[model samples]
Target: MTKRIRKAVFPVAGLGTRFLPATKSIPKEMLTIVDRPVLQHVVEEAREAGIEHFIFVTGRNKAVIEDHFDIAYELEETLQKRGKLKEYQALTEQLPPAGATSFTRQQAPLGLGHAVWCARELVGDEPFAVLLPDMVTMPAPAQRDRCLAQCIEAYATHGGNIIAVEETPWEEAHQYGIVSVGKDFGRSFEITGMVEKPPKGTAPSNLMISGRYILGPEIFRILEKGEKGAGGEIQLTDGMKTLSKHQPFHGVRFDGKTFDCGSKLGFLAANVAFALTNPEIAAPFKAELQKIFGTL
Candidate 1:
């Protein structure tokens, strides 16, 4: 029987250098999309996917990220006293059941593989999920397929390792970790090979690894070798490649859109996209956007 995937590791230690002065003090994960923090949105996605344990690999000056998931007692009490029941419920609603969240420090800006390795002790020995908080996937309006949820569903059938993949323009494939696909399985396909930022036009396929993954526990052993690739930092792609030799590697083409929130343009775009979905603001926000565009 396949082991259940109950835990998820989120790597949130990056210094957000791309966002500049705003990120100088704020951790990038805490940056807001519309009203909720980026990390919060990612957590909500994980929760929707039935991830029971949330493990965050954090770094220096990321206390606020931890606090965001914690109980804000004083704030909750104030809201209640002010007859703001809805506001109070909103504060408590997002909290994970106590003891479900764990935080570990990455301690260095080495790379993604290292950050994930930092969470191994917490993850123990089991198949687990990894979500790159930088990528926020929006579900289709009708299907409403959350990215990680789709990966988890595929994992249930294929049961080895699954990486969420999405097609990118062939011209821009070199900017991401591209995968060479094999045998088609309809909703999913075999991942024959992976390359981190293949040379322009030399990419094996236009399918790029979107930021969601369901990895077997054996991956920790491969990552433990600390082999560096691409950027000289330990690369998870290298580890996944090695693991693929021993385990089945497959890709699930996520049925949705993904926003890379680490970049300023992606961040700004995410705010607009999420704001347009916000029930309280979507109508006015659309009108406001039209009003602004009308002048131009």
Candidate 2:
């Protein structure tokens, strides 16, 4: 029987050098896409995927993120006093039940693997998920599947290491860890190997790993060793590659629109994309966008 995945780890320690000044004080994950923060989007996605606990591996200047998830009595009360019932409930209701949220600091700028390993104790022995907040997935209103949701369901059926994947042009494959599949199972396939940022035209396959992963508890063991790799930082891809050798790992090519909010261009695009679909702003936003475009 396949094990159920109930916990999710979020590694949010990046400095966000790409966004610079704005991220200097604010955690990049706190950046707003439309109205909700990027970090919240990933949290909501994980919650929708049946994640019972949310563990965040944070870094310096990330205290705001923790507070964001925590309850604010004063703010809620103020909203209630103003007769903004929905606004009051929005803050009070969305917070994870007290014990469901956890935060651990990654004191140093370690690689992704180290950050994930930071949450090992909290994750314990259950099959857990690792979601990068930088990767924003947009699913249609009627769509029940989020990027991580697909990975979780795939794990329930396949019962091995599962990672969400998507096809990218060979030229762009070098930007991500490319996967090699021995057998193609359409939406999902058995992963033979993974190469981080292969040279252009040399990637084994065009399917690049998306930011969501469903890994077994054993991955914690590998990460515990904290082996330095690829730029001397512990790379999660390295540990995963080692795990792939000993375990049955598969890559699921999920359906969804993903935005890498780590980059300025991608971040702007995500805002526009999300805003275009937002009910309160969509009508006017679309008209303003068209008017601006016509002028240019």
Candidate 3:
């Protein structure tokens, strides 16, 4: 029987240099979209996917993230005194039990592979999902859970690692890790190989690897010796390439919309999208947006 995937790792170690000043003192993961921080969205996604253990790989100045997940006792008490029971309940629901979550510091500003490696102790030998907090998957009922469940199912049937893929513009495909498609299996594809950010005209296919991944524990062994690749950082793509040589690899095209919250435009877009979808906030938010844009 295939073991159920119960743990997930969120790599929140990035400096978010792109969103400066705001991120100067605050970790990028703390930046909020529609009142909830990006990391919260990621954790909620993992939770929806049946992830029981949350592991955060962090770096300096990221304590705010830990605090965000902790119970805000004073705030909760204040809300209780004000008789805002629903608000208080919603706030408390966001706080995870202390021991249910773990944090490991990534001492250096290395690449994705190094950040993931920093959580090896917590991950141990289990199949785990790795989510980039900078990527916000939209409000699908299952969202990250659906993606992970699909990967878990695929892993059981095929015995390989699964990476999330999404179709991108053919020309822009070169900007991402492009996958060479083999036989299509409806929601996923058998990956022949992956080419990392190939030159504009040389990309193999339009299926770009998104930031969500359900990898086997074998990847940790490959990551152990993972050499620095493009940009002189230990790229996870490089480690996946090495692992592909030893085991079967597949790419699952996730169904939900993905927002690249790592950039200013994407962040703004995410905020707007989320606000529009939130029932309590949607009406006023839309009215304000219309007033501001003047029917543009």
Candidate 4:
């Protein structure tokens, strides 16, 4: 029987140079997308997919990221004293039990592949999910579940690895790791090839690799021998490419809005889009937008 996927690794070691000054002290993953931090959104998605063990591959100045998941005793006690039980419940709702989560430091800024490789010992021979906290998908029941759960299901059924993908414009497809698809499996496709940031107009397909992934343990071995690609960083795409040669690989077309929180424009857009969904803020935010546009 296939070992059920129970663990997930989150690579949160990126230096958010894009968000600069603000990120000087704060880890980008701790930045909020509405009310919750970006990492919270990623963790909720993983939980929905039945991931029980959460492992974070952290780096310098990322202590806040770990504290975010740890219990805030004073705050919880204060809320209880004030009869803000709902608020307190909300905060602790997603808190994983002790030992269910682990943190390991990625001593160097190698790349996604290296960060994941750092968690190899904890993962220990089991397939696991890799969720980059920098990406946030809007809350949509089936769509949210589809992104993570579907990847895991595909990994199980296909007995290999799976990456979440979504369509991108052909011209801009080169900006991402593009997937060469074979047969369609409804919401996903069999990945025949993967090209990382190929030159424009030369990409295999327009299906861009999104941030979510369900990887087999064999990938740790591939990553161990993986060389840096595209940028000077050891790209996860490079490791996955090698794994594909020996095992089945597929791409799930996750039905959801993915905001690239790693970029400024994408982050601003996500904030606005998420705020517009709030009952209290939506009306005021819409009015402000109208007034600003009218003045322009």
Which candidate's TM-score is highest? 1
Candidate 1 wrong stretches, greater than 4 Å = none
Give the TM-score (vs. native) of candidate 3: 0.94
Which candidate would rank higher by lDDT, 2 or 3? Answer: 2
Q: Mind sharing the TM-score for model 4? A: 0.94
My TM-score estimates for the predictions, one after another, are 0.98, 0.97, 0.94, 0.94
- Evaluate model 1: give its lDDT: 0.92
Per-residue lDDT tens digits of candidate 4, residues 108-178?
99889999999999999888899988888774544436478777777777767889998888988979999
Tell me how many residue pairs clash in candidate 4: 0
Best by lDDT: 1
Arranged by lDDT with the best first, the candidates are: 1, 2, 4, 3
Each model's RMSD to truth, in Å? 0.9, 1.2, 2.0, 1.7
Q: Please estimate how well model 3 matches the true structure, expressed as its whole-model Cα lDDT.
A: 0.85
Clashes of 1: 0
lDDT per residue as tens, model 2, 1-296: 87788899999989999988998888899999988899999999998898999999998889999999998879888898899998787677669887999999899987999999999999998889999999999875677788998887788778989988887887899899888988877878899999888877899999988899999889989998989987789989999999988889999887878898999888999999999988899999999999999999
